[model samples]
Target: MAYARRLWEGYRELLASEEAYDPFLLLEAVEEWPVFVRALRRAASKNPAEALRLAKEVWREEVPLRVLGVRLPATKEAFLAQVGLA
Candidate 1:
């Protein structure tokens, strides 16, 4: 979990610092971590729009409740509404 947190922080930092960073560069760093790689691929398989909404929530430091699991909004507008930004 600590490693994952560090990776997430590094990812955000890289995005903030680079105008045109290559995601593949990050991928190479985690190639040996199959569990992390699998989870990443699973998230990547999700609908892009919904994924973006969830990402927006995280980026805004408003991560959704995780009592059972995350319940992603069906649309961007719904996400905004849930976050009280609509």
Candidate 2:
């Protein structure tokens, strides 16, 4: 799980160079959003305040988008539920 988190972090770093790309579009392109959701869930369970801050950072509008260009997935609510915050 730690490794997965590190991998997600690396992916986020890569996104820094993809400023022309929509964050959601870029995230789905690489299929790292779900990994991020899972990691955020875990992080939320351990730290509520920090998790909330991170959530706001990642989901500024909290809008749901198609996952992998197919399915609309509500990852923020799902993560909140997983962390007992919903």
The prediction achieving the highest TM-score against the true structure is: 2
Against the unseen true structure, what C-alpha lDDT does each candidate score?
0.44, 0.55
Sequence-dependent TM-score of model 1: 0.30
The best candidate in terms of lDDT: 2
For all predicted structures, in order, the TM-scores are: 0.30, 0.49
- Cα lDDT for residue 24, model 2? 72
lDDT of 2 by residue, 1-86 (tens): 35435644564555455356566756554575566666767776787677776655544433422322423236767645754457
* Candidate 1 residue lDDT tens string, 21-82: 45575454345334433343345355445434444644453232221133445675665444
**Native-to-model Cα distance after best TM-score fit, residue 24 in candidate 2, in Å:** 14
Model 2, CA-based lDDT: 0.55
Off by over 4 Å in 1: 22-86
Q: How many backbone clashes does candidate 2 have?
A: 0
Where model 2 places Cα greater than 4 Å from the true spot, the runs are 1-30, 61-79, 82-84
For model 1 the local lDDT of residue 72 reads 42
- Count of backbone clashes, every candidate in sequence: 0, 0
